[model samples]
Target: MPRKSLPALSRRMFLVASGIAAGALALPHSVLATEPEHTAISTLAFDGESLLAGGANLVRSDDGGQSWTELPAPGPILALATHPERPGLVLAGLASGGVALSEDGGRTWESRSDGLPEGEVDAVAVASRQPDMIYAAVQGDGLWKSENAGQSWSFAMDRPWLEETEHDLLTLASVDLATGMGGIWIYAGTEAGLTRVPDCFCRWQDVQPGNAMDALVSGDAPPSEAPLPAGEAVRALASAPSAPETLYSALPSGIWTSRDGGVVWSHLVDRPASAVAVHPSDAMQVVAVLDGTLQMSRDGGATWTALAAE
Candidate 1:
């Protein structure tokens, strides 16, 4: 979910049980045509043979990238994810920080973020090991979690960041233990730095060894010059299912990579991407979004495919 403008807290529960609203896919007129970069795809994923991307609205393309059809959302969606074990159970995070569930793929949606946080949604993810476990990162809030899908939620932030700064959490990435080596890894990309909690009951500590991320999460050491600048956010995060240790992050500076979990890091490129995802089976295949355009790097980062319109 794009977080340029966050709605007020009073408008938290948008239980839009009604069917798809009117003008769900209205294209802008020629007079108001904007550049492709302005409509960057905020999030991307592959659901079976279909490609789903979220930005101004949730759009789906059954025939790859040839064309796309808009799926109605309560507001500009910032986050989207599918249940690993349950097909057709698509989860969407709205700009208002509300969560919606789609039982029939993307055809219909229903708000289920009743007990969740109140703000814009930055990212949403489901654990493959524990299929029922769902997590959301609220833009102006900390973290939220739900055990029974999105029907209900609770604040999952374990530290002071939960209530101290509403805008501390920016994005999140969860790696299921069943698919990975073992043990769950929930990475919370925050303004202070990246924090990691092994499981739902573990404590959160800065993933970056000696970076400012540590200071931001621990409040022990003075700000240190880490790869991430002071107060720079970890905007988007993704991990391949085959190799969960190989993590990717879209940071304020640029794309950052971690080969052995989040231990060591190096700046990949200065071209900032809003979100990134690696092919579940192929490590070489990667996709990222710059501005509103989508691009692919099939052969590692040596070359990139052309930017495609969403």
Candidate 2:
């Protein structure tokens, strides 16, 4: 579902169902008092102490989801990823042809797009085992890599399949890091299909076709009113820190999980979510940010509770 077409539910209803209202109400007035009335909570990433969200602007919550403080960045953030080893290091992909890195949590940011082709940075992720290395999916430009943090970057792969389709790399995720290779496994979701890129090679192999890619490739025309196909545009990808092989993809229709990399997947959740994040410390505790609010699943996406709304 496009962020704009989400159903309008009352803030009270949204908060009550998500079980975040009670926690948010307990937060100090200073932190919860200055929310931007018009902001939409688009993407979410956690740094242990605070939940960082990127949307129309950036916002952070020290007290769970009860209260929030705006942390404006230079541009609209399309994707957000936290370094697995570095507690505060964060990479933000911008809607424009740019990328930003934050060393002090998200309090500050700096642009780092050297050598990257001109295009929107659709996705961003850091090596869970190697925090210094980062990867990005540049729309129309293919994949890029930054070996030394975000100071500099180089094209990692630009396969003919990616270039010929003229599709943007909308989502990217690192599958496993236990192997010696810094980025052993990668998944790239494009308008054409999901591309599975292993560490040994630079070319991407297209996975099975589904509505998720079709919707985005066909311009948001969901196959069904039931949120299945719409949830597969590869809006978000997350790998459980505790179970590296367990990967989750946030598609337009719903959430899908794969226990053995991207070879097979099963539906995890049916809600239309824009982004999903796993608790770095607990895989069972995950959060999904939708167009108007947030959802939490304690049992690994078996069920969901709404948190808040615009």
Candidate 3:
């Protein structure tokens, strides 16, 4: 049976839940802080070697999710992406504004937002096959692309708008597939819904268009199984390099899994999830943020172990 969807998040709750709260600090602090110092997490990334959790701050765990150590972050990180071939290369989208690049894992970072507007970068993604190609979704500036890594950027597309208000993009991932235009697709989880654009930087389209997967030579049909719940905002998206077709999405309703690329989906965790990450090589090893806390699952999503922030 399908799990029941949770209540919709209010505008204010959505912002905080997405990791853009006003009080989010940049400096590193203890993993587990007292009530007054507690920080809410908004995103997660498992780069095969280290597990990173970002939001009001940042923390990394080298031994899976067993223990965590805080790292100095540029600011409240709204999104994170890792390079497929490079172990320590990480790109971070900052809530404060701009993007940051970390070469020695998450230990240190340098500003790499050249050419990008000084606005909250809600989402960032690195092409797995072409690490130099980076994409960022700025709060109001829309999507920006950088072919020379994050060294500099150029406008690629506009932010999604409904009625007259522009919706924010919460997450992004570069999936490796034969997308006619190229062999990869840039997937974005927006306030409006899940959309993807060929790495060619063309117009974004819904994931369910009948001919959506026409370019796919695998003969897979466009996503038709269990569709995403209407009006539920997608908070985060994570895909494993070893299992390119598999995806994990964090939603106000729960964590949904897509095994056939985006062609089909099944609800896994039946609760509001703020962020999710899968091992870069192992699709079954996963980590997710539930109710502002972190949980880990070794046997896929069948069972979970709450990782204490301490």
Candidate 4:
């Protein structure tokens, strides 16, 4: 029998995840289109030229959005990532099923949540340059690391510095890997702000408006929608491989950018962004989701162009 189908494992998972409710939580409030609710798109990832989307289920398009096929998964997928250079390596974060890894692209999968505290995976990320390293953001849980690919996880937030953090209440909305001139860094979207972690994953910080606020105060771009609040929850985030220092962070106030890594942040636009994805090869190109609409930006998210559903 397949290891994933083991009777004990299945029974435990069913009890732990609470079945359908957990799977539904993996998705953002999806747009209720005339189309079937199961087909409503949520988030997106790119594997080569193929586009993969998830909401209530998993779907893929090899030739852009001209055609899409529903893909089988252990449960409803919440977030996904594809290896940049690897032709057949995919990782998925499930709503209530934890994380799964695939060596034959999306054709097959194996469970990889041995040490995860919670099976509700909110986001997943993998750097193509080093495929063996992967990260998973568990909802309400701080984060988990898997050094040996996605075989297992070492729960974070055990550090003393994170003791003050309410990882149980703070929902990790999104996570992305940044690599380039500055260095390799990990970005996570949270209710407070966009959080960043170093290569060692020993410590972390968030995007603060200290020095960057000076530029905004002087009217570099424009006055923000309102005064920055005491706490800002990040809706989504994306980082380009070509520009590691650059981070696009979506906050309730608007979208902001960090040029010198995530140290300083400046408001770029005052538009709501629910989700974001950077181009695999081009840092200047980015895709964002706004009110369930697809928008693309070729100028490093400085501007955007809306894309109608196909």
Candidate 5:
């Protein structure tokens, strides 16, 4: 299957991002397509017991990635996040604007963008420890949070302002690892780099060390810096709920995994990946979107098998 360009909203955001880092925005031609005949997948999530894939279409697989069944989706899905414990609770960030809540797995959906801004929702993540707590990264607007599932939302944080540009956030995730502060960490992948803030709503810090301003925030040391070269951004992020310390991030460089709660990272996959997901209960079973196709690795990333689309 040949990949195509993403929808209009994502393209527009990429154009804006190109102003700061033009090379990083040179997306391959096989990412997404709007035509129904051409299937396009950009994001993946584990719905506790099953795996959900979305972009131009939505599909669910109960038996890992061996088989799939198409599911209902409001529109082109930009991102997806499912509750770690709630079997059927899912959140989908739409390319159109706002988000949709699906409680009956992906079979049904309801609009849940009450307080969100009118722009594409780039990414969304639901807290594992607190299923009701959620985070969304809106395109033009910054990040938004919801305490009561997706009933409503409020501003949580602003996008990173670097090099005179407010970098657009491309992905978001809420990791359960304790931050020594009052809460876990909420991370966002932007055009600039990977940045995170303790749920305490304190200050945001880059995952890469050596920031003079970060020194004045607290004595707490920064998490292990990701090995991405300067100007590379994390394009997608996923962390295991059963093992909060385990994290997988997809970037233009490739896929990287962290076992010590983002303290130490090791490159796992060498090719660029658009999205990644770990089984909610089993961290070793992983799936990633490579060149707009689905690939699964049962023993972490030691090996991989491409899954045929149904």
Candidate 6:
């Protein structure tokens, strides 16, 4: 079905608070006639021109943020990863115990959860170099892998990280394989911190404190509508395809960028961003979602301009 843009907020109030001209802002096109009650956007991925966003709802957009289309999937989407080589191939990790694959640009979807444990799927990663390789992090199951392009699955990690602590895994990102990173390096974001698992899936290491990992372990009753805690609680993470050494992490304070391959980091943005994605064609072009608002940056995080939502 066609997507619906968010409800129009008070433009006069927004402009007075943000000090921007309301007339200059472009309104979002109503992709759907009616908006759903809950829309928890957990992850976002781009396929050159179009964007695939997963959360409580599965959605796609071809004209940046101007218009969106809702894509029906098997279950509530928690994570999404687009195929590196195949433009239309996309995979979605659901809150239920399975993953969904779409070969025809999300017009239709099929479930692939033969080996996945019956639990919420927290994270997913597609190997940029090895397009056929897929990885998923199950809430109670450490990690699962699909080598046949989501056709079949196997346990990638011997032990599940979710079992080690009460916290749950939230996000996953793969480093560019061409950088000699060896295999598709996967980074798992959790309440404890950031966990690094080599593509080989031999061992997992804690790369949170010393490394550029910043995270927060929320209590059972996390705030229903509040941003994560500052200084900790990694809201999101994205790796640059052009520069493997540089990765960006979203924290409560703002966004941080690391140039030394997750070793050293520097602050990039001050506003809290819940999700971020870099354009595949232009590494410097970035789009971030903050508190239901979308912002864009073309100068590699140097400056940001807010995109209006209608």
lDDT score, candidate 3, position 80: 90
Q: Candidate 6 on 1-64: residue-level lDDT in tens?
A: 4545322222111111111121222323424423221224566777767876666555677776
lDDT of each: 0.61, 0.64, 0.73, 0.56, 0.72, 0.62
Count the clashes in each prediction: 9, 15, 0, 0, 1, 7
Off by over 4 Å in 1: 1-38, 158-167, 177-182, 208-231, 307-310
Residue runs of model 5 more than 4 Å from their true location after superposition: 1-39, 208-226
Q: In candidate 4, what residue range of length 10 has the lowest lDDT sum?
A: 2-11
Collision pairs in model 6: 3-31, 3-32, 4-32, 142-160, 215-233, 215-234, 216-233
Clashing pairs in 3: none
lDDT of 2 at 131: 83
- Better model by lDDT, 4 or 6? 6
As a TM-score, model 1 comes out at 0.74
Task: Please provide, for model 1 over 1-310, each residue's C-alpha lDDT reduced to its tens digit, 9 standing for 90 to 100.
Answer: 3222112121134323333332222332211111123244667765554556666555665654555555554566667776445667677777655777776667666777778757777778887566677888776566788988877888887432532553455566786533122567677776666766655434565554444333544677432234454467777777766677777777657777776666666677677667776666655666676543566676645566654443
Report the backbone clash tally of model 1.
9
Runs in model 4 lying further than 4 Å from the true structure: 1-40, 127-129, 159-165, 168-183, 207-230, 264-269
Worst 10 residues of 3 by lDDT: 2-11
- Indicate the residue-level lDDT of 206 in model 2: 48
What TM-score does model 5 achieve against the real structure? 0.82
Each prediction's TM-score against the native?
0.74, 0.76, 0.83, 0.69, 0.82, 0.75
Clashing pairs in 5: 3-30
Candidate 5, residues 16-112, lDDT tens digits: the string is 2111121111212222322222125668888877878777666677776555566656667889998767888888888778788778787777778
**Model 6 clash number:** 7
User: Would you list the rank order by TM-score, best first?
Assistant: 3, 5, 2, 6, 1, 4
Q: Against the true structure, what is every candidate's RMSD? A: 7.4, 10.4, 7.4, 9.4, 8.4, 11.1
Clashing pairs in 4: none
